[model samples]
Target: MNTSPPTAIVRGATVRFGDVQALDGIDLALTRGALTVVTGPNGAGKSTLLEVIAGTTPLTRGTVDRDGAVAFVPQRTALTPRLPLTASDMVAVGTWRRAGLWRRLSERMRGDIAEAMERLAVLDLAHRPFAALSGGQQQRVLIAQGLVGRADLLLLDEPTTAVDARSAELILDAVAAETARGATVACVSHDPRLIDTAAVVVPLDGGRIDQSIRDAGRGRPRCPA
Candidate 1:
């Protein structure tokens, strides 16, 4: 394992959307190589947390400090249709921030693209048109793209949405594998079972995280109130 300390911190965080308080007083610590799953019912501020961490939305309160680059996979796959781009091309976009705006990819960049695709089991899809894939396939491709950066932190919002159990398991297993490799993963899911693999399970209700305890084997990680 990397043995590095936490690379991301979400402390006393809160967010408001007009009349709705998306998040309320949330404190979270994501250490390197830990997979933390945030589980809650609908309207529990899952996506909001991811957005705040990714810097797409401003924090209404508190702080989220990411020590290194963070990769985010939104609930909706950000695949562009009719663009004639392959899955490999989409993954390559993840490296864009590392290069100057006008700079082209070097041989090393291309190698990274291939490696990321292979890592996520999407190498066979590398030449396939991204838009032509099914929902599950697209989800996997997006995950592959997100991993291309080898980011210190990865935030996924409902990553298993619309996928079958087999596909979902594959995604979750891959996420766990990444954690073992020393990357911090913060994922949100409405499914309680998702928390089974999480080192930390945070349940939120009414915009506040519920006081909960972790019990991995029971399939119910939340404490009985």
Candidate 2:
């Protein structure tokens, strides 16, 4: 790790959507180079937490502050089903920060995209239309997209929900590599098996985090709860 401070900080965070209290008094500190897995059942506010960290969700109370750039790959991307973009094209969008919206890609950028696709085992699907891919394939491609360019904070929601065992391993391996390289990677998943690899296993229930488990991961890591 580069000795950077927490990549993201959430203090007494709360989010309300209509009648739903998505989050309640959440305090989280996402440290750099840690792979934190946020686990919970459906409606446990996992997705909302990711959005809040990414700065896309409006909080009803509390605060979320980031130390650097953030990249979020929602469990389901909002890309229209009819868009005629290829899987590779979708992943390349990660490099848009450097390759302007309408600009061309240089050799270096192309290499980065290729490497990211390969990491997720989606390099062979480069020519396939994104919408035409299976659910698992689409999920892998979306993950590759979030990794195309290095972001200080990388957020993923249920990244392996639809993938098979092999693909899930690849995705987790890639996420682990990102944390090893100094990115704060926060993943939301319901699979408890993931705890075996996570630096921090944060279990959410009733819109509140289990601080006992969370505090253990403050500096010393342990297996999932």
- Residue by residue across 195-218, what tens digits does model 1's lDDT show? 666766777787777875346465
- For each candidate in turn, the TM-score is 0.85, 0.89
State the C-alpha lDDT per candidate.
Answer: 0.77, 0.84
Q: After superposition, how far is residue 97 of candidate 1 from its true place, in Å?
A: 2.7
lDDT of 2 by residue, 17-88 (tens): 899899998888888988888987778888999899998999999999899888899876555776699999
lDDT of 1: 0.77
Model 1 backbone overlap count: 0
Q: What are the RMSD figures for all models against the true structure?
A: 3.5, 3.2
